[model samples]
Target: MTHRITVTGRAGGTPGTGRRVRVLAPAAALALGSALLTACGGSSDSGGSTTVTVGSNGNIFDMPLKLADSAGYFRKQGLKVKFVTTTASTGTSALQSGSVQFLNNSPTGFTSALAKKVPEVAIAVSGLGNPLGLVVSKKFAAAHKLAAETPAAQVAQALAGSKGGVSSANTKAEAGLFLKANGVDPGKVKWVTLPSASADKAALSSGQIDWFITSEPIPLQVQNQGDGIVVVDPKKAPMWAAAQAGYGEVVVATKSYLSGHASAAKKFVAAVQEANNYLATHQGDPMVMDVARKVQQGVPDEVLKSSVALVEWPASGSMDAAGWTKTLAFVNSLGALPDGAKVTSENWTNKYLPAGGQS
Candidate 1:
C-alpha cells in the first residue's frame, strides 16, 4: 500500500515529548548507558518496574504507545516504558546496540533493518487501514479535471511527468509502487526530495510540486486548508485496499530483549494491545485528544480530528502471518531488504500478544 515517507520529526511530530517520555535521541544514539540497562532488564534504577526503552519516529503512527502511557496501561502492566524519539535508521542501530528494547515503525522499515542482520522480531501489529497516500493540489486537480471519483488509472496517466514530493527514498519507492498499481509509468513521475515538513507544505502551495505522497495528518492538514485534495486514499483506493488487506504497522524488538526478558516483552505487548483496544472504541474521546495534543504538539485540533477520522486501528493486537509475508515481499521488491538475509515468519511472534493476536 502507498504510505508516506516519514523522514523527520517536523514531518510527523517532535519525538520524545510524549506524556511519559524520559529521554530523546538524535537520528543517532545519544545515550548508550540506558540502552545497556534496558537490555539487561534488571537494573537497580528500575526499582520494581521493568524498564523498556522503546524508540519511535515521533509521528502520529506512534499514537497508540503514547496513548498507552497516558491511559496508565503501562503502569497497570508493571512496565516502565522509556521512549526514545529517533528515526528508523538510528533506532535500528540503537536496537542492535541494546539502546532500545522496542521500536514502532512501518513493517518495511523493520524488514530492511532485519535484512541488515539486526536480530529483531515483530511483536504486534499496530494501526493499519492504508493510512499512507498521495495528494494533489486542489488547484492542480481542478485544472486537470481530476475529481475524487476519477478512476485511479486515468489520474495516474494525467500525472505523467509531474513533479511529486516525498519524504524519503523508501517513500519514493512506495510512490512508485502506487503509480504502477494504478497503471501509471513510475519512471515518468519526477520525484523531488522534500524531506522537511515545512518544505513539503511550501512546495505544494507554490506549485513547486504538483503532488505529495504522505501520511496523516498532512493529508488532513492539506484538506483542512483547502490546498489539496487526496488523489490516492490508501484506505479507499482499490489497489491499496487489496495490497494492504492484512498489513498496516508493526511493533518490533530485538530478539535478545524477547529472549532475555520474555515477561517484560509480554507486558509491553499487552499494554500496547490495551491502548489499541481503547483507540478502537474511543477515536474521538478526549483521552485521544489529550494524548494527541501532548505528543503532536503544535498540530491543530481540527487537523488531529480529521486525522483520527481517516486512520484505522486494528480490531485486535494480532499480526497475520500471511500479511507479514506479503509485506516482506513488497519491501524486497523495493530493494530495501539486504541480500542474503533470510526472510520468514519466524521474525514475528504472537506469543506475547493478548489472546486472539495469533492468526
Candidate 2:
C-alpha cells in the first residue's frame, strides 16, 4: 500500500516553478484505519470469512432474518451480517448496484427487477403463509356491525364506500385482494396512502380511514392502542390457506453475486433456515421474541408475542417452482406483475437449499 502527499508552497505560486513537492510513504496507517472498518458494504475480507450487507424490510415479517443475526447464526456460518436500511422501493436497486449483497423481502422487488432485465435470484424462504391482518376503527366496526368472525359478504359490504389506509404497492395489493376475494368492487373503496405504520394508527384513530390492512404486528399494535380491532386474520382465511406461497417472504441475491459468492449465499440460506426452525418451534422463547425488539420500533412484546404466534415458518428453507408460481399469481391478481415478466428459473432456484421439508 502507498500514499502520496502533495504539499503546495502557496496559492500564488506559478505552476512551472515546481512549488509542489510529493512525498511517497507507506499507507499502513491509512490501511489500518480501513481495516478497522472491516465490513464495507458487500466487500470480502481477504484473511477471513465473507462480510456482506443484507437488507430486511425492518418489520415483524422479517423477524426470521433478525433471529439469524441476533442468535449468532450468521457468525456460525462465518458470515458477518451488516444490515443496510432498505425499503421495498430501494432494496432491489441496491442489490443490482452491488450496494446490497442480499435482500430479504417480498417477491415484488425481485419480480419487478426481472421485468427490467435485472437478474436477481430467490435463494431461500423463511415464512410460508400470508400474515396480513385487517383492522377497522371502532366507529367503523360499530356502524357496520363488523366483528372478527363477521361473514365475508358482510365484511365486504361494510368496507364498501369506506376509506382504507395503504402504505405501498404491497398494501394496496393486499387491500385489493381483500375486496376481490369477497366479490366487492374495488371502485367502491377509497384507499388512503398512509406512509408509515404510525401513520396507519393516526389515520384510523382520527377516523381519517375506516380500515387499515397490513401485516403483523401493526394490526396487533393498532388493537393494543384501542383505536380498532382486527376483522380479518389471513391465517384463518380460506383464501390464504388455499394459495399460501413460500415466496411471500424470501431471501434474494443478484444472479451475478450468487455466481461469485455462491458459498456465502448457501451459508446465509442455511443460517436463515436454522433461524426459521427456531422461530417455528420456539416462538415463545425469549430469544425468538427479542428479534422483533431488535428490528421493530415501537411495537410491544405482547403484540409481538401474539403476532409471532400467528406467523407460520416453513419447516424447510428451500423454495420450489409451485410456490413461486402461486406467489406470481397473487401478484398478478393485484395487476402488479409487469407485462411479459415471468418468474422463471433465472429469477429463482432451489439449488442452494439444504434439502428438507416443503417450503
Candidate 3:
C-alpha cells in the first residue's frame, strides 16, 4: 500500500516571524501556481492512491497525524499525506493556492481564515487540552510570595499591571480570555509580542518580562530549566480549560477540496481516528515515542513523554459544538475577530467521522 509521490513545491516559511516578506510574495505566487498545476495536472500513477498534502506548523500537536503516516495508516486508507512545516498563516496561503490539501493547527487559525472567507472547514479534532499555559519567573513568583503550586487565577491577578510576553495578538487574546474568566483584568496587563516561543522563553529567563503565555514545549522547557513555574496548566485551568479544549488542534480542508475529493477527505478523517485510537491505547509505548521524536525534533524524549500525558485526543475524533461556541464567544469578547465574523458549529461537521466508533 506504499505509494511514493514526491511533493515538489516550496514549504511555508518559519512560524512566529509575524511578517510575510514582500520580496517573497512573487515567489510564493509562483509556487502556488506550480502547486495548482501539479494537482490539476495529474493523472496519478500511484495505483489509485490519492496524495493528500498537509501543511503544518511543525508543532508537537501534529504528532498524531505524523504518527499515522509512520504507522502506514494513510497507506491503508489509500492516501499519501506529505506534511510541510509551514507557519499557520502560510499554511492558509498554501491551502488557498492548492499547495496542500489539509492544514493542521489551532482552530484559532482556522477561525481567522474563516473571517477572511477562506472557506476551510475542520474535519476532525486533532488533540485537546489547551496547549498554551502561563509561566512566571521564579524570582517574580518568590517576590510576590507565589508558590509553584499557587492557583492560576491568583497568579494572573498578581501579574496584573505587569509586562507579559506572548507570541501573537491572537495568543494574547486567548490569555486574556483565560485571565478575564478567572476575574483578572486583562486590560491591566501590558502584553509584549515576542518574535517566537524561543524568544519568549529567553525573555522569561532573562527577566525581560514578568510572565508570558505560550504553548508547549516552551512551557515545558521553562519548567525544565528551573527558571519559571507553570502557573496555568490549560488542562486544569480553573474556568476556561474546557472551552479551550473544544478546538485546540483540528484537521482542516478547503471547501473546494472537499467538494471535489469528498471520499479522500473522509479517508483522511478515518486515518486521524486510527491515529488517535493508537495513542489512547498505546501512549508512552516505544513506538509512540519513536514517532513523537520524529515529528517533534529537538525536543527531549522526557518532555515529549510528559506532553503526551498533558494532551487528550478525542476517541472518536468528534467535534464539540458547545466548546466551539464558547471559543468564539471568548474570541469575539476580545474584539479580536473581524467585523461581522461568526463561527458556528456548522463551520465544523462530523459527517466524515468513521462509523462503528473507530477509536
Query: Clashes in model 2: which pairs?
Result: none
Candidate 1 C-alpha lDDT tens digits along 1-359: 12233434444444545422433434224345545554464342535776678888877768889998889998898877888897866878877777777888777677777677777898888776556657888888988998767877878888889999987776677778777887788889888898676677789999999998776777667867888887777655543442554455778888877887888878888888888888878887899998888877877898787676565677667766667666666666566666765457688878898776655
Mark the 10 consecutive residues where model 1 has the least summed lDDT: 1-10
TM-score of each: 0.82, 0.84, 0.82
As a TM-score, model 2 comes out at 0.84
> What clash count goes with each model?
1, 0, 0
lDDT of each: 0.74, 0.77, 0.76
- lDDT for residue 285 in candidate 1, whole number 0-100: 85
What's model 1's TM-score? Answer: 0.82
Candidate 1: residue 336 Cα off by (Å): 2.5
Q: Any runs in candidate 3 off by more than 4 Å, and if so which?
A: 1-37, 41-43, 238-240, 243-245, 320-323, 344-346, 357-359
Compare the candidates by TM-score and give the number of the best one: 2
Winner by lDDT between candidate 3 and candidate 1: 3
**Compared with the true structure, what per-residue lDDT tens digits does model 2 show for residues 1-359?**
24454654667766655423222223655565465443233445665767888887776668888888899998888888888888878988888777788898777667877888877888887776667788999899999898878877778878889998887677777777667878888788887888776788788888899988877888888888787889888754545532554456788888777876778888888888898888889997889867777777667889888888776786687766777788888777667777877888667777887656334
